[model samples]
Target: MAENMFLFWGSGSIPCWKPMIVLEEKGFGGYKNKFITFSNKEHKGEDVLKLNPRGQVPTFKDGDIVVNESNAICEYLECTYKDKGTQLIPTDKAKRARVLQRMHEAAANMQQKLVLDLLYYFFQTKEEDRKEEEVAKKVEAAIEELDRWEAYLGETKAFVAGPDFSMADVWFYPIIAQSIRMGLDLGKFPNMKAYYDKVTARPSVQKSWPPHWKEEPPMISPFKGRI
Candidate 1:
């Protein structure tokens, strides 16, 4: 059996979903999950803060090692579990460089934009408190970056970095899925819409999304498949 693993996560959070998707894709078994509640300030509590000083969701514990940062968690899984399943970060130097680049872009750029938009619009403390103009600007920037992703897809096949699904896709999928949930219409970008549909249909994604999330109608649907 695999070593005992624990993941600290919040329901429907993109960062949390990244590692969860990686774990499912790696087919690692025997892991435990602790669901943190943002509403209750569980993430900011002492116990979780000890593991993640930033007080972020998706902290990971494996044996004596505790890791925070979603990308770092995913990278650790790839290296530690390299022999367990399909290689996520490519072995080739150039290919791996491209994969890592895309992963960073998705994390630093795309996810940031989506998070800002969601914070301003859906999760704002008051209806009037929502930053309508700022949200629109951020959404436009996000769409521009998403257009680059679509172009990247057009140049490649099957996955983001290359022919096979890699960590880049894992990083990208959850952000897009959550963005869709926040009412970003995918119809404006057909390629991205198609790519989003393809990723959400994966069994790994289906498993990563919380059960409660399934009850809500998808805010955006680029394909017939339910996410």
Candidate 2:
């Protein structure tokens, strides 16, 4: 059924991981996928450029239909095959709202604001250009945000939005897992650690696990303090 569906993705990319998980959940686990190496700049090649001008993986093609963004691809799969496998988006109105809220919250806050913010301090800045004091302040702000999520998970003890593993968990599990892989210190946030463990154990997550991560571990933390 997913024969014409093709995905150009990068290994260990959190955004790239999302749609793969969605495809697996939607019973399209056998969809054609080619890994694009980031270091090799393959994403910028003509294949990806034709589908995604931004040169990003998760340049997905469903027959002639193209969806570039990871979250949008996941949404497309869920909407296209709502009844095939897992019901990612909940049916209940309030529950659906919660799922959507958490999904985008995870995207904007944890993934972009917190994770990428710290990553910029490391990958984007030269050591000679480092500002210790400024980076420390950013780390503190990130810790406070993590604490809010920790409190939420500690209170709920199920999924990000509720008991059921819905689209919110699909959207969120990778943030927590990838954050830990990138050295967020699951030890600092025990509740989030538990949440990560719970979701990581799910079949969809395990099935779609980044192929590269198995062979090479992600860069570890130089900053381990919880702040």
Q: For every model shown, what is its TM-score relative to the native structure?
A: 0.85, 0.93
Local distance difference test, per candidate?
A: 0.77, 0.82
Count of residue pairs whose backbone atoms collide, per candidate = 0, 0
The residue pairs that clash in candidate 1, if any, are none
RMSD of each: 4.0, 1.7
Candidate number achieving the greatest lDDT relative to the actual structure: 2
Alpha-carbon deviation at 142 in model 1, angstroms: 2.2
| Poorest 10 consecutive residues by lDDT, candidate 1 | 218-227
lDDT of 2 at 208: 87
Off by over 4 Å in 2: 220-223
Could you tell me which 10 consecutive residues in candidate 2 have the lowest summed lDDT? 218-227
lDDT, candidate 2, 66-157, per-residue tens: 99999999999889888899899988899899889988888788776566887656767877887888788878778877887888787778
lDDT by residue (160-205, candidate 1, tens digit) is: 8888889999988777776666556677667777788788888888
